[model samples]
Target: MSTEPRSTSEPRIAIVGAGPAGLMCARVLHNHRIPATVYDADTSLTSRDAGGSLDLHADTGQIALADAGLLDVFAALARYEDQAKRRVDQHGTELAAFVPDADDDAAPEIDRGQLRRLLAGSVPAGTVHFGHRVTGVEAVGDRYRLRFANGGHADADLVVGADGTWSRVRPLVSDAAPAYTGVSFVEVRFDDVETRHPDVAALVGTGHLFANDGAGLAIVAQRNSGGQIRCYLSMRIEADWPRRAGIEPDDEAAVRRYLLDAYRGWDARFRPLLTDTDSGYLHRPIHALPAGLTWPHRSGITLVGDAAHVMPPLGGWGANLALLDAAELATAIATQPPGTALTGYEQRMWARSGPLAAAANEGLARFAGAADHIPDHRAEHQRYQADAAAYRAARA
Candidate 1:
């Protein structure tokens, strides 16, 4: 495929989805004095729960934030002391523990809602159109047209699909879709943990706790801001396990009982992580696209983040990769012509994310059975610090 440089100095770019990838792209473009429009399905920024906390790695996620000129603000809101981690067995025995040094900021934790609000605020006002759920993408003569579910239409010179797993613009470039990964999570949260759930707070500590049973069952909890703790009870089960097991999703009590039964051999100490919750249960069936997925470059259309190469959440690489993708794409567009920039961005994104996606898949598969030994979280953090130091040195 060949792309010609736009005759006009500026091209009309339309970005689908206002998640991390889309919003970061818009913010970076704004920093470069380029204009782009973003459309999101949510009615507002607070339309739904923004999920849990995320640790932004220095090399990837932080670099993107620095480029968008929000790193300083992020520092103020980041929780540096929450970098601690622990892993335990079904008997509530500690397998491993890692606590970062006081000065270490390699990957600091921040709530998803706070991060989204920070990025959204960095972009120009009116740049994002909420409630504009896109239905389809159609190719016109030389441009792409977006059809919204609200019977609205818009055409643009370039279309970016940062719409995540079930992207509406993905089919225009590739035929790949996310597939269920044979594992699911029932997510629940406890509010005011230090006061209402002191025991749970102590179990979770300042960061994350992973409790695993050798037989394909695990409970993971992480501390969020506002004195809340979010927990996920995960198991290797079919995608339709709820339906097949005759469990109504809306029935919280039924789901809790089912989870308790499933986790039957585990220590009684782990029960509160499943039973005491301030919010309703959220059933999440994990899914991912094929590892190292790539598509032939099509003119005027491209993808970023999960839309390009979505994999199972392992090592918290998904959001970090998305932030890097947005920063790189925006930089390319600012320095190069439209067509060449899109192609170059795609190639670089594929090369960078392919191996990470493969590793994530392998990591997710480990949940199938109990491992002979647990990973050394301290060693992993040291490696990440070394890598980040090298990256900074090279860039300097």
Candidate 2:
């Protein structure tokens, strides 16, 4: 297995996972007239739920979209007004609020599904091969071979792992794995909010409503498109609490009882968020790789997005970082020599994501009550907004 840089004239590139990172990479590579194939395990594009909303920051996410020629399309679909944020205590009393100016588009919100669709549609139709579940990756001479669960295989000169936290391709480069962060969220939703659930709609407001007791309990709700409200009852609990407590994930009543007991002394206004829902409950245990993690560069393979650095959703930086990573990686691949491009991309990614990953871990601990003091999230948002503004100005 030679580790030399392969010819750039027609390097065979394979991107694992069709999430934002992989799709963005393919789109950018296509823009440069470089061809890459993306493999995803899902049967189709809409096979699974696309998750919640995301606020793409100007310096990171927006820049990536602009590079891919999707910024104008993104701006048109983004919810600029929904950038407003509200924080409240357990009693539903307002603690702080930050309403963005009418013209403020520093960080605009877009549905996760919407963003995925935009990126997916940007690439060529046949660029993505669905239903290909990668079972393992092996070095074949100077190239790499990907074995799919469907008894199929494909060989590539270079492999990019955008497969996410539990990426199969990650082990080929690093030994680090995602560990539970001692926090879990039971997600619920309310559909037709303005008509069917006006009270819930008002409670959540135009953007996001965070009701934290500062003692490890919170009801965080965000307004999605189509007048729907998605709520996450977050808590610091045992990783296997559901199974140990004999609470089946689908047992909505049991989960509701557990949440009600956990939040026993909270105000009654927050109950509706837990009880009324138009979707099944999703138990999500937060997990993250070690902060500031780095691995020695290996030729013929590298990573992007969550596959490289996954952290808590503290500042909504996960997807933004992933997008930026894809754009940078694609740019490097298109310009630099094969081996040098992977090495340089890894160095740049490490330097950029290390501090943000550390901060996200700390913010998770504070938000989950591992620390003594309650976090001032509103203040944090203001600082982030100001920093983004400064970044754009400096670049301009």
Candidate 3:
């Protein structure tokens, strides 16, 4: 549940879910000399960072990082010159590739692990309490009392729900929940992609290589910071495909065999990605907040990241929006009273995140299975590229 407004000498804030959103919220708040405690259900911060590479855009993600003073740290870990793009047919025939102009100031790619570690390390060591899964929320005077699964409790003037899509804290503010977008991803990875898996690596190219027919089948490979290749297989299948197929992600051989059987007629190089796998297979079904999910201001409570507005990862706005939310919320609170800042932040976050969320969902809907919708994908992608460049230029 959400928190009730409380009046404290220090404006105690409780941030849930310690991901990019929660950590950034806490980091920004700490920068402004506000006291906040971060809570996460994970046993530790290093639980699991198994997402693919992410390119921090110039507008949202980069700006937010700069505000948090972690731009340099992000750059130090960024994989510049890894922004190649391409589209191919199901048979692996290259269709189009936009030669990218490389610049050190360009969008720098970082492994999801690096981004999380950097953000987690920046927050004060003792500020975060791990293994504290929130069970419920109760209003106490102007503040809220947090109940933990371990019989522990804490009170705060404000509670920020940075927990992801299935946020336990979200139910308190609004009954809105995330719904599936009829898409699911089978995550695949290759070890030492270059030497060990030359053909597959070559098929992947430098950065992103997508093959699709626009209906349901797609193979997208993204190069990670290390010598690993992160691949995503998109399919329009029954929701119970995993159970029906009896697919055991832990069984690498079975997973590889399944891939071979599924995409049998596709290019041989593309087949080995699933064939020669080093890591376990994983599934992620995209879910998003409805078109315009907003709620009335609930004093002492707000949301950031997926908890606030979950959307598909087409534009990679998940972490970026959370970072921006952190910077904006902290700034608002520092410059005004609790009532004003909390209310103002919610209004702005809802208005600001709606369109980005829509755009992300749109990308997943069209581009997920329709990578080869050539004329359309190319025209749309270029327009976005130009828009991104323009945004960066204008900011500069």
Cα lDDT over the full model 3: 0.78
Worst 10 residues of 2 by lDDT: 1-10
The segments of candidate 3 whose C-alpha lies over 4 angstroms from its true place after superposition are 1-8, 104-106, 248-251, 372-396
lDDT of 3 at 240: 60
Pick by lDDT: 1 or 2, better one? 1
lDDT per model vs. reference:
0.88, 0.87, 0.78
Give the per-residue lDDT digits (tens) of candidate 2, residues 122-176. 9998989999999999998988988999888888888999999899999999999
lDDT of 3 by residue, 106-159 (tens): 455788888888988988878788889988777888777889997878888788
Model 3 residue 27 lDDT? 81
Give each model a TM-score. Answer: 0.96, 0.93, 0.90
Q: Which stretches of candidate 1 lie over 4 Å from their true place?
A: 1-9, 392-396
What does candidate 1 score on TM? 0.96
Model 3: weakest 10-residue lDDT segment is 372-381
Shift in Å, residue 141, candidate 1: 0.9
Give the C-alpha lDDT of model 2: 0.87
Clashing pairs in 1: none
Number of clashes recorded per candidate:
0, 0, 6
